[model samples]
Target: MFQSIPWLESNSELWLQISIVGLGLGAIVLFAETLHRLTGNSSELARKVVHIGTGNVILVAWWLQIPAWVGISASIIASLIALLSYYIPILPGINSVGRKSLGTFFYAISIGVLVAWFWPLQQFHYAAVGILVMAWGDGLAGLIGQKFGQHPYEVWGMKKSWEGSLTMALVSYAVSCLILLSVQGNVWQTWLVPVAIAIVATALESVSKLGIDNLTVPLGSAALGYYLSQLLPLGS
Candidate 1:
């Protein structure tokens, strides 16, 4: 298993960094969720604050290491734009878009660009794939689950559903695999890496007792992708 995965051998440090970031994000999300639950607020505000703070940290870290001004600027600007859009309301009928939704979309895109620009180039494809998967998969799952979920499974005293969870897992896996394979130039091995990532990400999504899927899913998916890439001929 170890011998088959060359990306891991070459980029272990990158994976470690990704994992650490993921853990930090997860911790913050959990804290925010707890506070929101206790105070009867949406906790969306808390999440935005964390998002901006984390984006700054990521920008500094990447800038010091990479000297990539484009990415650093994008991260800061995108985050600010996202936050501002929440309050300023950019377009006509923009309020229909919803602040949280807009904020999350911009935040996810910024993270995706940052990861793509700063992380090891060889593993950049995986990180990008993971980001896309987290954004679309989680968003769709939440929307569909809320609107259509009739039967619910009680998880951690919350009413969730097998249908929603399954949808999240499947969509995340499919999208991640498609993106990774396209970038890595290895369409055949898609089954090996993406499936593993999907499963891990899905499991994390299912039991995210901390409401940190934003932080957990992308990073977790990246780790799983990295590990799988080691076992399969994944990236450059």
Candidate 2:
């Protein structure tokens, strides 16, 4: 039940683009961790860098006009390798984080699944917003919360804070709105859906444990954004 690879030969340019993007993204992750180790820097910061970098690289698929399948395949393969690295320690960046969770693999799989199923139907923007919110929003929340979390709270046994959750919501809304507007338009009417999506995504992230938020935040945002887009017209 297999077919010939379309991006292999006839589309050498596509293959090259995929290879460059994949290698560049991988290098970023590896280099970030290596730099941290070499400098005796904090390991947590390195993981955050990798998280944001991986999410941002998804945009390259759109930028380079790479086929969705190739992008999806790359995500799946990389995620699988990351899952293995948990045991093998092949990629220091993948396992350098002290947290005991498969969130990294989950993050990769979530993005890959979205690209394979949702992207080609013209709703790729939703996936982008979701991943971006997880990347920048969630990533920043952790950083800011750790640095200046004065008001603390717990959600479903997870220790977080008003500072972090609020950051997640605000940043998620901003990033979602910016990406959506860039792709759809700058219509004022389109604001509500992104706002709703951001809230839902943030809420989902707040309660997630064992790194489950990696799967929930992006998928939840995409699903919410997609449904809301149907109900609420985003056109001017």
Candidate 3:
């Protein structure tokens, strides 16, 4: 059955690329684990290390032109491992956020969904925008909020800070703009899409409960980015 799938076929170059991606991802997890255990780092710190680091895999997949099947398969395997980490110590440092969460699982699912949605369309920029927003935007927000969040507020029983939200918005805007501008040129839509995506991503992240934004932010940002890109078109 697998033989019939053309994507199943692979070349030596593909294998090498796949191996590099795997090792890079493995090294990230190992580094997070080492940081957690050796340095007595907080679980949240270790998890964010993995979070910010692993979300970068989208770049690797895009750069190497990894097949959609491989991306999807890797996501599925990652989702399973994240789910299992709740019970087992598989990369415990990455998931031990000191609270109930399926953030890791949702994050993995976002990758698979983005690859499935845009890989065939050859619009990888949207996928990159989504994951990078989550990686840099959300990831940096958490780090900044933890360290320098003096003005704390509550959103639907969730605590947050303006500093963090601003970080998310700014990073989301920057990430989307850089990706879209490179692909779509210096158009008004390019500017508008990033602003829209930044607002939407920040809103979704601000009210996230139990890490639901992991699923919502990336997929939502990508979809909205693509949608607005079509609606606004390149002009002005």
Candidate 4:
């Protein structure tokens, strides 16, 4: 039966659903970038918006009850669009955030890939927490580091600050705690898992180069969180 074929049936609704979310996200980026230019806020803030926006936008997939492939396809299409902006000078504000790298592409790929991998496992929370940490922990690290970094060190010669790294760890821990608590409820054992995930996530973020930390932080954290969730009594 063709029912097994994911695309044999009309996917127009799926396409439309993704398109609407796509447009919404694009508008958000453009608007945030304009504000960034007007206020002279560091590009990192706009970058955070994009990072957090991309991660959270998956909620639309959940909302519309779309299939996993629909969500993955949407991410790929959006990534391709953002990738084109690099050459065309559109989305310049988002482009201005990072050095020469395809972090944007990886960000898109990370979302979809992690979703596909974790969806079947019912461990999507790990993916969500991972992306959230990368968004908040890494995003805030850059912003705070740029503003208040005093004691600097070199990780893989990339020149980071103790302040930023510490921020990454703490914020990651806090975000992890909130996510786990909401999904798994307040249990004594729940606190221990995020601590481990935060540590591993921080280390991975520290070593990744060429802006690949955008991908590494989330996937690494997700993998660690997934394993820990399995081992720990995550829920009562």
Report the number of the highest-lDDT candidate. 3
Question: Model 1 lDDT vs. the true structure?
Answer: 0.59
* Residue 108 lDDT (model 3): 95
lDDT of all predictions, in order shown? Answer: 0.59, 0.81, 0.90, 0.77
**Between candidates 1 and 4, the lDDT winner:** 4
Lowest summed-lDDT stretch of 10 residues in model 2?
A: 90-99
Model 2, C-alpha of 117: deviation from truth (Å): 2.0
Per-model RMSD to reference: 14.5, 4.3, 3.9, 4.8
Error of 1 at 89 (Å): 8.4
Q: Tens-digit lDDT track for model 3 on 1-236?
A: 44464554537688888999999999998998999999887788888988899989898899998999999999999999888888876666677534488889999999999999999999998999999999889999999998999999899899999999999999999999998888988878878888889999999999888899999999999999998877877763
TM-score of each: 0.55, 0.90, 0.93, 0.84
User: Could you tell me the lDDT of residue 2 within candidate 4?
Assistant: 31
Evaluated against the true structure, the overall lDDT of model 4 is: 0.77
| Candidate 4 residue-wise lDDT, 84-188, digit = tens | 876876666677433576777778888888778876776667767878888788888887887899988888878888898899999999988888787888887
Arrange candidates, best TM-score first.
3, 2, 4, 1
In candidate 4, residue 172 scores what lDDT? 93
lDDT of 3: 0.90
Ranking by lDDT: 3, 2, 4, 1
Off by over 4 Å in 3: 1-10
